[model samples]
Every structure is written in structure tokens, then in C-alpha cells.
Target: MRVQALIFDVFGTCVDWRRSVAREVAKVLPQVDALAFATAWRAEYDPAMARIRGGERGYVALDDLHRENLQRVAAEFSVSAPERLAHAWERLDPWPDVVAGLTALKARHVIAPCSNGSIALMTRLAKHAALPWDCILGAEIAQDYKPKPQVYLASCAALRLATDQVMMVAAHNDDLFAARYAGLKTAFVARPTEHGPHQTTDLGPESDWDVIASDFHDLATQLTP
Candidate 1:
């Protein structure tokens, strides 16, 4: 199927989550253990989402999740943080190629972030990074996270496009697999450093994804100009 729109995964895909978090943490607590704090904060992400998904906890937006994780990390490390620190997630710096690559893709297709991030968080991140998305679509709209077929289908439905007409671009293999199962074309862009030096999975494409690229710029090159 010809792709009419490209749906992107924001964190760790378009932006370097580890680096961004580390930088923000360092800025707030220069003498603190930034890397450890970043790692600890990210470690809480999946478990928090799982709780919500498993019906063990109420629905919480990505911002809330980040805040909760940040609080825990700060307490664990004996670091003091201001209330405004949670907004740092929205101020992440994008990968060097994100702007140019997204601009190239936007010239031919509708591009947006279909991520687990909330709309407000994604919006601020896009603006901060100057990510030229036509729109921002998030799990907040679907009330679920990636690896769920419903989130992928919901994005297609919101764009008023068929599943095959849309493509999911992500750094994670599981996310691409979920999109493929939802009947959408898939692109895998490797972000091997996403987990910092402890990276253990997703070193390359794990399935028969439609296309696998070194990064977003490479993915844009593979698609028709």
C-alpha cells in the first residue's frame, strides 16, 4: 500500500530521551547524579503505564507519569527539585536530523507523532525541538500505550485514513510489530543508544518491517521524494 501519512514515535525515536533527561536533570541539580536520576526516572515509565493498563490504577497522562517518576527518583537520590522540573520532558532537544528529515517527509505526506505522550506534552516538545509535524496524536487520545493495536488504529481513524495508508515509524521493534498487526505499514529507525550504555534489545529490526533505517533521515531517503 502506498503511504499517505507517517506516524512517528516521539521519545527515543525522534528525540534522544536519555540525553534529554540527563541534560534536564543536570541543569536542575548540577551536583547531583544526573545519569542515575535519568535512568531511575525512565525505569519507572513502563511499570506506571502497566498499572494503568492493567486496571490497577487510574488513567494518568504522560506528564503525570513523568512527574511521579521524577518525584520518586529525587527522593531516592536525596535530591531536591522544584515543581517546574517536570516540565523538562516537554523541553527535550530533538535529534540532529529530526528537523530536516521531518521536513523532507512532510513535503510528501501527512506527518504526526502517534506516541504515548499526552497532547500538551507532545506539543511543547515539538515546539521546543522545532519538530515540523502536521499534527500531534498521542495515547491521550486513545487512553492506551503503544504495542496496543487500538492505539495504532485510533491514529489512523483520527487522520481519516485507512490502516494501510498510514505508516508507523519507530525505534522499537515491538512498536513496529504492533503497528503491522494493526494493518499499517511499518518503518524501524534504530536508536540503539536509547537505553544508554545498558541497551540490550532492538539493536536492529527484529521482524520483517517494511523498511529499516539508521535514523529518520535515512528513512526519508528510502521513501519516494
Candidate 2:
């Protein structure tokens, strides 16, 4: 496919955001259902970004959106939201295969995150998860969010690669759809439990993606030279 770079959807595809955030939520809001709380907070994510994507608001970093959502969820749960809790997004843990898989991919092609996360958030999360990233590219670079053509195209531009020369690796069919529409290659990595044990969405590939793998380890074997 002439792929020179692999851009990833970081939150669920690389890291287990639901569990990682729930762990932190449990520590801070012990009285509430942490998993439920984490899920609730995350549920606010797309709607919040939609404001910007739809031009109802100017662009802001994902950190700000996270903080805003945390406040609302905390109030809904009748707990005082700790200011520091906003930083929890920066402390996500990667899936078990992520580190080794990304390391292998890095050996051959450039690897970076094409996430909705701001560069600062992505950088800190990379450090926390020990992800081997070649660079950070995504919403911050395009001043927009994912599912938007600009976000995917800008990420490829940042790497100085043509759309076809880059592959967007994501677990979500919608994400891959957007990336493909932007002219980049697509890879679907099944993260069946990204939303936890009973996760219903993105359990498998929904299209004829360029590559499909069971996990990052499998993805590395398929994509890495």
C-alpha cells in the first residue's frame, strides 16, 4: 500500500481509556460508581467537541473539554470535582500489546498519534504509557477534531507524506471511515473491550479496511517490514 507512516487513534485503540480513567476516578470519587462515572464523563466528549466542530465555539484543547465535562459529571454525581482530576486524561494506560507493538512498528515506519487529544495531553499520555511515538499530530495541528477530513489530512501533511502513503489505525469504524474519506489508508484493530467487558461498539472491522488485526502485536506483524 506504499504506507510510510502509521497514525493512530490513541484513546481506545492504543490505551484502555475506560479502565485507566475509571481507576483514577475511583481514587478521587470513591463514593460513586467509578466506571459509570468515567463512562458518563466520556459520554460528554463528542457532544462537547461537536460544539467546536459545528462552529458553535472556537477550538479549544481536549484538556479544557475534559475539565468541563468532569465538572458536569461531578455535579451530576453530587461530588466535588477535584481540579487535579482534569489531568487524569494525561495518565492513561496503554493496552498490553501497545508498547511492544508500537516499538516494532517504529523500527520500520514513522508512528504518531492522530487523536483528538491535544499535543500536551498526548505527550503526557505517551510518557505515562511508555508509548514510542515519532511525533504528535491531530486536532491541535488542524485546529479541529477527528471525523473531520482536515484532522486526518493535516496529520499526514505534518509528516510530509501523501494521504495514501499513511495509514490510519483505529478501532472505530467511524474513525476509519473519516480517514479513508481523507484519502489515507486504513487499518482496523479490534479492541472489543475498549469500553469495558460489555462493550458493544467497534468490536470488529465493519469494512474492507486495508489491514485488520486482533491486536497491536498482530498489527505489527502485518504492517512492519
lDDT of 2 by residue, 12-72 (tens): 9999999889999989789999999999999999999999999999999999999999999
Candidate that would win on lDDT: 2
Q: Estimate each model's TM-score.
A: 0.96, 0.98
* lDDT (Cα, 0-100) at 186 in candidate 2: 94
CA error at residue 66 for candidate 2, angstroms: 0.4
Candidate 2 Cα lDDT to native? 0.94
User: Cα deviation in Å at residue 207, candidate 1?
Assistant: 0.9
Residue-wise lDDT of candidate 1 within 171-223, one digit each (tens)? 88888988999999999988888888779989899988998888777888999
lDDT of model 2, residue 87: 94
